[model samples]
Target: MAYKITSQCISCKLCLSVCPTGAIKVVDGNHWIDSELCTNCDGSIHTVPQCKAGCPTADGCVKQPSDYWEGWFANYNRVLAKLTNKQDYWENWRNTYSQKFSEKLQKHQGQVPA
Candidate 1:
């Protein structure tokens, strides 16, 4: 089975940078994993799917049952193509990511040793 990116994604693009197979896609703010290109990182290079590990949001990347994943791409694309508000969707995601990043940075900065 392959992984899929859910609505919880914050558009950080970490998954894209870490994906070895280049299976994860972000087109017009719609993110999805191409099962055809996704190997789930089964090989020795990584113990976990990089996309999942790199994703900051809990449950951002999820596994799909093999049967359900078979035709997921076509249907997903069909639905996303109908949406016309991609710019707003992308901006919202970017804002969310920036806010979370700022919060985490502040928390970590507080722990700096003197």
Candidate 2:
């Protein structure tokens, strides 16, 4: 019954402060919710889930699917390959240049230097 933060999160940290159990955290520049710590605001201070209520972006906070993939890296690679139409190339790119790409993305987002 925990909520999951999607890529749509703007890293605003709104959910971080609002979560009663402090389940939300920033990981690799994305906001993620620790399911073990999440209480879904069922009997907590808030009547509703704080993460979902505080999120600025629509659909940024969503209920964790029952069959959510725990192996995110594998799922990510598969999706990337499908979208780019280059499975091997994308796999290689992710393995070889992901760090550089992340750094560049951070810089572009003004979170780091170019």
Candidate 3:
């Protein structure tokens, strides 16, 4: 299972360096586990990831996500929105981009390829 960093991570960088896959990331003032990279090699275990060797306890590395994890990307599209939550300009651009991308994706998926 992917190792998730709980709120109890204590902001320590220990596990950050131990993960062999380098799937750990610090975002929104906390550590995050990328499920896409998590292999779940341990059997019958909860959150005791070997990658988190430096963590003080199992509880420290296990946790559910916070309500507003989007806080980390506050400036990802800053060129448009004044703030991440405030969809001012960048938000509009994102919608436009997604619409175009969606159309192209559908077109490509339906192609018979000559």
| Residue 62 alpha-carbon offset, candidate 2, angstroms | 0.6
How does each model score on TM-score?
0.56, 0.56, 0.43
Write down the TM-score for model 2: 0.56
Q: Per-residue alpha-carbon lDDT of model 3 for 6-64, expressed as tens digits? A: 65568777877766666788888777888876654354343555655668854576533
Q: Count the backbone clashes (under 3 Å) in each candidate.
A: 0, 0, 3
Point out the worst 10-residue segment of candidate 1 by lDDT: 78-87
In the range 1-114, model 2's lDDT, one tens digit per residue, is 678888778888888888989898886887899999998988886888988987899668877755557546545765776668864776887777988888888778996455
The RMSD (Cα, Å) of candidate 1 is: 18.5
lDDT of each: 0.82, 0.81, 0.64
After superposition, the stretches of candidate 2 with alpha carbons farther than 4 Å from their true spots are 67-114
Between prediction 2 and prediction 3, which has the larger TM-score?
2
Itemize residue pairs with steric clashes in candidate 3: 1-40, 80-90, 81-90
